[model samples]
Target: MEFLARATGVVGGAVARLRRIGTPARQAIGANPQIPQARPQGIMTLKMPVAQGWTDGRLPICAPGLRVAAFAADLDHPRWIEVLPNGDVLVAESKERPAPPRTLMDRAAQATMRRVKAIGDSANRVTLLRDADGDGVAEIRTVFVQDQNQPFGMALIGDRFFLGNTDGIVAFRYEAGATSLAGQGQGLIGFKPHGHWTRSLIASPDGARLYAGVGSLTNIADQGMEAEEGRAAIWELDIATGKARIFASGLRNAVGMAWEPVRGTLWTVVNERDGLGDETPPDYLTQVRDGGFYGWPYSYWGKVVDDRVAQDPALVARAITPDYALGGHTASLGLCWMPAGTLPGFGDGMVIGQHGSWNRARLSGYKLIFVPFADGAPSGPPRDILTGFLSDDERIAYGRPVGVAIGPDRRSLLMADDVGDVIWRVSGA
Candidate 1:
């Protein structure tokens, strides 16, 4: 079971990498007038290509390019990460506000909006990075808004930067050359926030479409499924037109997205349903089809049903479970693909931050894994690369990582640590 578990984790990781890796670096945006892929309404399947040099199951123990660094603020919840054209960073500090009053069952339902503020202040903050001199590292920058409330995810589109908060979206004129938010921003939407309130955003290569994640409205409730319960899915919006619609559903929580143009798919790393036993519901990584569903408050992993919502009548047949699944409740987040690397095993691979385990008695996660891809899709299984971040000796970890960006350097990597108040950098040494 352990080997099989690892195998599925590896495959799911790779498939996730294949689905969501998007960039115009490999090729220019000629705007192929292509329609969305035709997939069954509620079917979930793992897609990948045949393997070659990446067949053997081996990955770097330390993930080759990882180096931890400190941040300016005493960050309690550094939620989102974005890289600018210049050698700087934009990080959203989701304040760890005091827990709102709630009953036991309602505790798990808490979200970003429920809390008043996160860090010390009641307002959420946005901190920028500035190297000042050519020091190869960001030395200092300014905090754009020190009095904002719970800023979550954001994307850089042209001269304007779009950000997501607990309530809605905002835009700021970003001047990369001067390291500043140059102009006044406006609110885009006024959507209500919930427990799964981490709003990660994705924009088209041409910056036409904006994709954001809205987590489930309940902690696993059918009674709460009054049209809004599991609306915690991916939303597609025309940035120019402001038209928004649900792109996919059945995902309990998906805070990360990557686009794989080779196969033309959007993949996500999902934080699946909790409250099951230590190993009941497995987290997953798979291509999200348009209008696809993945069985929230009902089933999981395509077959293994969750007992929490077993008796609920609404969970009859609509919950489309996932394709490739990972270990139960690993809280998988940030997803990225390693373009063919200098190392033999890392050629065309994927890496996911296993954001550590919370419910399990015997702690799992607290590391990153590598998944191999072939023909621009996932091929073989995943293997542990950045392990030991959590101390198995005492089941203690100093950091919990969230956002991951390829970095300002073309070949470098960056990881945002919410618990450690730091943004780490990595590259091939």
Candidate 2:
């Protein structure tokens, strides 16, 4: 099975490259389907299939009560999405590094701090909107605030929106028509940024707990875990109190997180510690318990210790590997459990967006999969429900999914694609 998997990787890459070059190579491959396809296969097209719109084949369904809808589109580097109590979708429509809106919030003396210059780097403006009626779309929307560093996660409690940028977490008020930072900015997290910033987040089912994921401080921290370096970890804090702590530790990077509705368990799709050759470490999705330690700089996936952080024989015994491991280097990202009988083989399974492989020679991921999750836990091997997003052709992708949100209807799945710069709504067949 390992040999066959390797063969799959080899052939998949050749086929992808062959898809790039057009002509006799293509004809030869077309004549011999078993052989790898030719390069530059075809032009990748951007198409968004609306719920009832026409598509090439069977359409994916939302859970019976769920339906997909576009909250917003065409923004700059949008990363996070949060819906408020009054039916407003707040978007972290991020500005680029050295973000220009640094001084926008500096009007007050208290807001003027030297570190604000550091905060100035992420200044991605926030956008807030309302559907007014409970329609599955946004009607009246406007820019809410600015000056955040890679604002990728958000938590909203009474009268405040706690935004998570790479450097720290800041709070804002969610007035329906207000267009600026309404309250005094309070910094809740203090991490010196050396660029390991993929801060995705989720709240406890009850809106009381704000769970923030801080990626390793560096790409591969030279010092390692003692300092909370490159490994991934989750931080839990109270919205009202503004106090926070490291909830769990030693994750290479958990970019996607959600609180399972049924179990009230905090779960995350982790981007395992990388640089292990090509397919050495597997990414994972699992229930995260507070104070529990998962192997990071030390061991991984239950048994394969990284050997980077020299393991104390006793520490290896104590590490917690993932509950379910996706195939190695799959780049698993945004995830949403199947709403209902959305996908046949995967009834109420966990639906994950595999963002595709970047550094690997073989092309994997790029498909939305349904991993059998029963009673709030993983059951079996993941099933591919939304596949073929990347056509047989090479050249370009329509989009790379970043966020997956279940709708108010509770049946449709809403996916935000960063590459295509579009939000996709996939409903049940």
Candidate 3:
């Protein structure tokens, strides 16, 4: 078995290298990306960097005039972050739940996941980080909530706290400065577990509703549409009545969501479907409309049909084009609004954490980026905020940024580096 695994890795690595020989740098980026026609391949491209953690206090390189430091360290796979009213930061520490391998592709994917340190038993907990002295580093670290089913998103509304577990939203009674949750939580909304399992939650501006992102159970609904009935869409849950309804549909993997303050519109960064060519159907950042559809299986990029899926003409016609493309296979996930003046030389914009990609021969999105906003829309090309997560040869990853949030100070930025097991803080130098 060991010899076979080694042989598979050698073959896969060689194939990946050969595919990268003439691959051009990514072109599908910015507000008007040149999206190429899809070229489906019988064998999907698979390339992932081996995970090697940071050493000797080395940190990610920040953009000029900005500096980064470890705000909190030594946590288990922290995937998402939330800041409380009292300046406490909450980190949701969890990982993907490994599924049993049933096919050759599945077995290969599992092996790749293990090689990249991407698959493991979830820690199933949320930890609190407190910066009591107003320094960038967190002085207090404690487990706030435990035994969760892969909790990823958290929201505090009034005295009630809500968590987005893999299976549902759970509510708990919260105190302003409490270190840990005291009682059992009540499940508010139930959802199908696993298969793009990170449930990202954000509170409505009015605080009467909560929006949760539930990803599809299978890529392109290959498991059939019935299995995807309530997946691949954001659900709006009424806090008072616990009634939930689908807010928007056809978002393949809308992981990060925030409100664009200028226009009062909700925005999200979505991870597009795979199996198409490296540059096909670029992942996007868009203003999410209340009942709008943005094609998933039927079409992509506003009615551009994907012949792989069973067609639905009516649905395709209604598909909305995303506002901006963040490059293909970038895995743009974490998103947070940064008001003007939060970071030096950076005006009001959205910050995205691209967790990097594995489905492409040449890598894309292994860094933190910022997209400037004007009149509540993306105004310019993305700017690299932090980089150097990958090694010079691109064979090893030092870290992968996941969830981003504004620090409680409202000046610094906090990012969850799942692979590095650290919460990084970025501030003006």
| TM values, all candidates | 0.75, 0.72, 0.97
TM-score of 1: 0.75
lDDT of 2: 0.57
Task: Report residue 415 deviation for candidate 3 (angstroms).
Answer: 0.3
Q: Write the per-residue lDDT of candidate 1 for residues 380-427, one digit (tens) a residue.
A: 666765554554342235555577776665565566665556666655
Q: Top model by lDDT, which number?
A: 3
Candidate 3 matches the true fold with a TM-score of: 0.97
Off by over 4 Å in 1: 1-76, 96-99, 105-123, 132-136, 182-184, 227-230, 310-321, 342-345
**Count of backbone clashes for each model?**
19, 31, 0
Model 3, runs deviating above 4 Å: 1-8, 21-24
Model 1 has an lDDT value of 0.60
Rank by TM-score (best first): 3, 1, 2
lDDT of 3 by residue, 1-429 (tens): 334445556766777677676554656988778887787868777778888979877789999999999999999998999999999999999999865766787777777787677878889999999999998999999999999899999999999999999999999999899999975599898999878999999999999999999999877988899999999999999998889999999999999999998889999999999988777878899999999999987988888999999999999999999999998889999999999999999999999999998877778899999999999899999999999999988888999999999999999999999999999999999
Report the error of model 1 at residue 78, Å. 1.8
TM-score of model number 2? 0.72
